[model samples]
Target: MALVASLCNRVIVMYAGRIVEQGPTRAIFKNPQHPYTWSLLRSMPRMDEVGKERLVSIRGVPPDLGKLPTGCKFHPRCRFKVDRCLTEEPPLGEVDPEQLARCWVLMKNVSNPEMQS
Candidate 1:
C-alpha cells in the first residue's frame, strides 16, 4: 500500500473479483468512499504509529470465489452495511469529483464512530 501510494497516481480497489472503488490515490487514501476501502485502510499498519497503534482487522471471513454472495459481495463483512446491501448490488457511482465507489451506504453519509477523529 505504501508502495502504491508512492508510485501510483490513481488506484482501483477490488473485492470479490469486482471493482469496488477507483480514484486518485491521494483522494482515495485521504477519504475512502467504500466501507471495504475504509476497513482496508484501517487494517494496514502505519509505520509512524508503530507499536503505539493496534492494527484493526476486518470482521468475518472472505467469501468463497466459486459461490459469492448475492447483492453486494462485501455486505456480509462490511460494518456499514444497510438492508439494501443484502439484496441489491450497488453501482459504481461517483462519491466525489474524481472518486467512484460501489456501496449502498457510502462512508460520507454514514456516521462511523471509529472515523470520528
Candidate 2:
C-alpha cells in the first residue's frame, strides 16, 4: 500500500468499500488527517530507519465488510478515536480544495494550518 501510494499522483484510502480520505499523494503523506491514513503510513517500514527503529504496525484485524461496526468502521482499531467516532459516521468534507476526507476531525476544522485548502 505504501509503495502504491508513492507511485500515485493522488491517493484514496478506502475502508469497508468507502473512501476514508482522498488527496494529492504529497499532501496526504505530508499531513494525513484521518486516523486510518496516519496508522497505515506509520506502519510501513522505512529504508532510512531499517536498523534505527522497529517498524510500526496498526493493531487489530480489518473489519468485516459485511458486518462493519457502527459509525466509523475504523473506530474499533483507531487509537485516537473519540466518543463521536464510535457513533457518528463522518462525511467526506474538504480538507483543502483538492482534498476530501471522511473524518469529523477534518470536517470540524477545514482551515488546519498544516493542510489549508
Model 2 agreement with the true structure over 76-114: per-residue lDDT tens digits: 887666789889999998888988889876533435422
TM-score per prediction, in order, is 0.93, 0.82
lDDT of 1 by residue, 25-55 (tens): 9999999999899989989999899999788
- lDDT score, residue 25, model 2? 92
Best by TM-score: 1
Q: What do the candidate models score in CA lDDT, each in turn? A: 0.91, 0.78
Off by over 4 Å in 1: 115-117
- Provide the lDDT at 36 for model 1: 90
Compared with the true structure, model 1 gives a TM-score of 0.93
